[model samples]
Target chain A: MGLKEYAGKQIEIDDDGFVVNVSDWNEEIAKAIAAENSLTNLNAQHWQVINFMRKKFTEDGDTPSVRALGKLSGVSIKELYELFPKGPAKLAAKIAGVPKPRGCI
Target chain B: MSKEAIERVSIIISKGSLEGVYPGLIMANGARMEGIEANLFFTFFGMDAINKSHYENIKVAAVGNPGLHIPTLLGCIPGMSALITSQMNKTMAKLDIPPIPEFLEMIADSGAGIYACQATVEMFKLKKENFISQLSGIITVGEFYQMAAGGQIVFT
Candidate 1:
């Protein structure tokens, strides 16, 4: 019933402890994440931005703030709302293949 | 089009106003966020924005900006530029955005390229060392256009 019990049952934890396999991450979540990260679906823009953000985190050891992410993609912070209606952390987490951000809850 | 199919964009930072500098930096930064390679070429007065000493310190002209209204008496006043710039900086800081220097650093760290216009640099007698450390290199307009050629070019 609690989070712990679900961990090893129907859901499994990935190596990073960021997300658990829900088996229902869903197409809507997928599409929202893709758009939020700027993936065109034509050439994996979503994956590229997500990968670049991951690389930046790996090298800089910091998740880029929204402003920083916006700058990198020539998108405006005002415009970011259209991509991730749930916000970047939520959307980016999904696209980056990571779990939702810890503080998001 | 797919991300792989789209060409990267080149952003031109051409304005000298205090309000003008941020547009170029922000745009370039945004381009990188979208996974696009972005290059910023600062020329003329725009050069002052990237120069280490002046960029952080520059202020907007409050009276002449046309958007600002401080009464006609203040329009002709000599110190209005400082007043407007100071107020603008306060607003930006409150918004939690970095001031220009730190913003430029953020852009550089994000893999956004910074370039100083060679002609503008020479005309102003600015040496490479005068620029912020973020610069990829100083280059000619032709070279800048070459990098920008097929890609989208934005002038801010």
Candidate 2:
């Protein structure tokens, strides 16, 4: 784990660059993470997914899988790939300050 | 550790059994989840995995299988294969693993290429409509090799 500054706060992040403490998350931090992932624009659709992920983690104690995100996140599977490019679920979870979803799809 | 990562993979699915088809699907899906390019080539009995009428009805091979620990003769009994298949399906469902058709859709949507073998399609006298909608196309082995260039090839 490493400590990094985002939005003027020193936050701890894991080896995968995901925040170690979910409580440390904020909209500014999310935008910083998104920019690091080359997503410079956090548009409405992007916030929808980020909010959905954070809400699910708060309610379920775990991040949703790509399949779950596709089915319930108001984002289609093809569009999820378009939004996150490489790995949608993992990247979104990282930006959303949640643990990566486990298991193979 | 080697600095080079696997950028792409071409998986060959040649077995028709339920066990045979899932490994390739899982691998292809896993690759996409990791941002790796993946391709699936369905040939021989494996065509059943992509075949519209057969994809959903794939059964476990109960006979001549030592993994079940049941007598081979017992496996030959009527309804044994179906029983095992249903039980396996239940276990898979509990694990959140989708059935074949849905799995194919997921893999396809994940940006992996799903292709059918031209030779097998011809041998079975099948058309494009015989396979699932997720199929990228029917391709020859030569074309598969062309696509597999610069990538690893795995036979499942």
Instruction: Give the candidate number with the greatest lDDT.
Output: 2
Error of 1 at B24 (Å): 1.3
* Each model's DockQ score: 0.07, 0.77
| Global lDDT of each candidate | 0.66, 0.91
Q: How well is candidate 1 docked (DockQ)?
A: 0.07
Candidate 1 structure quality by residue, lDDT tens digits, B1-156 = 656544477888877787788877777766665556778889898888888878877777555556785675676688777777788888877766688887887667666688999999889998988988878999998898888878888888
Q: What is the TM-score of chain A alone in each candidate?
A: 0.48, 0.96
Worst 10 residues of 1 chain B by lDDT: B27-36
Every model's TM-score: 0.63, 0.96
Q: Model 2, residue A66: displacement in angstroms? A: 0.8
If you assessed candidate 2 against the hidden native complex, which CAPRI class would it receive? medium
lDDT of 2 by residue, B82-133 (tens): 9999999999998878899999999898899999999989999999988888
Off by over 4 Å in 2: none
Which ten contiguous residues of candidate 1 chain A have the minimum total lDDT? A1-10
DockQ of 2: 0.77
> What clash pairs does model 2 have?
none
